[model samples]
Target: MKSLAELAEIRERMKSKVVLREGGNEIRVVVGMATCGIAAGARPVLNAFVEGVNRESLTDKVTVTQTGCIGICQYEPVVEVFQAGKEKVTYVEMTAEKAEKVLQEHIKGGRVVEEYTITHAKKA
Candidate 1:
């Protein structure tokens, strides 16, 4: 049980993350969270992206959200990144570790983690 003050503090901490998801961001990270995705462990991958965005203070620039099946169940736990002026990049076979690296390299560093993306995954 938390005191009112404690709850308030928690709310404040979470408010930024909520805002990041709902609006005002240039980058959008969409994780497939359907039944298939969950069975394939998308929850941890989603958590990693959320935690990574918060840790890097990228909430202002990156928005993380979830969606239904991305029509790629064979590639469950898929993540798609969308930027206003760029093409969407779909990453498949995601794990928490891979999500973290995507946050660091693709989201923050302005370069896609090609090997983790569908285009590259299909090649290997």
Candidate 2:
């Protein structure tokens, strides 16, 4: 917060930090936080994931984040798991309880919960 040159240098440092961190081998848990998602209790689901990560002391191994409109409003409060060098797993209609199960069974144990996946739904 001094001169323009100082501000530019700070901005460059922040950008570099983001890029460096983004290139790491961290698992990302992205929760949908659009209006539909929020209405369906996305906040608690997000909080549960954060709490689980912290409780397990896997902060460096995992990152909890949010997104908007996953294009499936019926599956609001969706949680998508992205592990480096692995296919993404999308969990639909999440709750705090379910999120904990996901964190334990999926994130920690490296197993996807097939029962909660959208692919398991019956097409009408």
Candidate 3:
């Protein structure tokens, strides 16, 4: 705030934490953040994805972003993963802990965490 150089420094630091949607990433992880989603705890789920991606050094491959209502209110706190040339996978009833597992098993390992997926929720 004191000088132009200091402002630039702050901007650079924050740019690392901000996920831009300009597109080049191999995968996109979107979190639903509608009113219902927030009530069901989407914020932490979103943060978890962001932090997990950086921690795993997959930021170049994955982009984590938030969007309003994903349609299924019952599935509040929902997360959707989109990979190029692949079907989108939706994960429901998410928690921060679940986010990490999804990061490791799904994002890094190239496998879907089916138990947390919408199809599994329907069966349950």
Candidate 4:
């Protein structure tokens, strides 16, 4: 059981994350979290993005969220990045490590990690 002060600290931290999600002008990082995705390990992928975004102080520029089936069970654990002026990029078969790379290269550096993308998956 946490003391009131501890609980308040937890709430403050969570409020910051919630605020990040409420932004209207930030790049969106959507992770597929449907049953298939979870079975394939999407949870850690989602966490990686959220943590990385916060750690990098990119909360003002990025929003990480989850969604249901992306219509491709084989591509469970898919992540889609949407920026205002850029075409959406769909990354397939993602892991936590891959999420970090995507956050750095795609979200932060404006360069997609092509090897993790759907096109790359199809080619492999």
Q: What lDDT does candidate 4 reach at residue 95? A: 98
* Model 3 regions more than 4 Å off: 1-7, 10-23
List the candidates ranked by TM-score, beginning with the highest: 1, 4, 3, 2
For every candidate in turn, the CA RMSD to the true structure comes to 3.0, 6.0, 3.9, 2.9
Off by over 4 Å in 1: 10-23
State every prediction's TM-score relative to the real structure.
0.87, 0.79, 0.84, 0.85
- Across residues 1-124, which tens digit of lDDT does each residue of candidate 4 receive? 7589998899988886776566564699999998999999999999999999989989877888889997999987899998887799999999999999998888989999999999999999
What's the best-to-worst order under lDDT? 1, 3, 4, 2
Better candidate by TM-score, 1 or 3: 1
Q: Which pairs in model 1 have colliding backbones?
A: none
Predicted candidate 3 versus true structure: per-residue lDDT over 76-99, tens digit per residue: 789999999999999999999999
Against the reference, the lDDT scores of all candidates come to 0.92, 0.89, 0.92, 0.91
Better of 1 and 4 by TM-score: 1
Residue 1 shift from truth in candidate 1, angstroms: 5.1
Tens-place lDDT per residue, model 1, 16-38, is 77755665789999999999999
The superposed Cα distance between candidate 1 and the true structure at residue 44, in angstroms, equals 0.3
* Model 2 C-alpha lDDT per residue in residues 1-124, reported as the tens digit of each score: 4799998899888786566555464799999999999999999999999999989988768999999997899888899999978999999989999999999999999999988888875342
- How high is the lDDT of residue 61 in model 2? 81
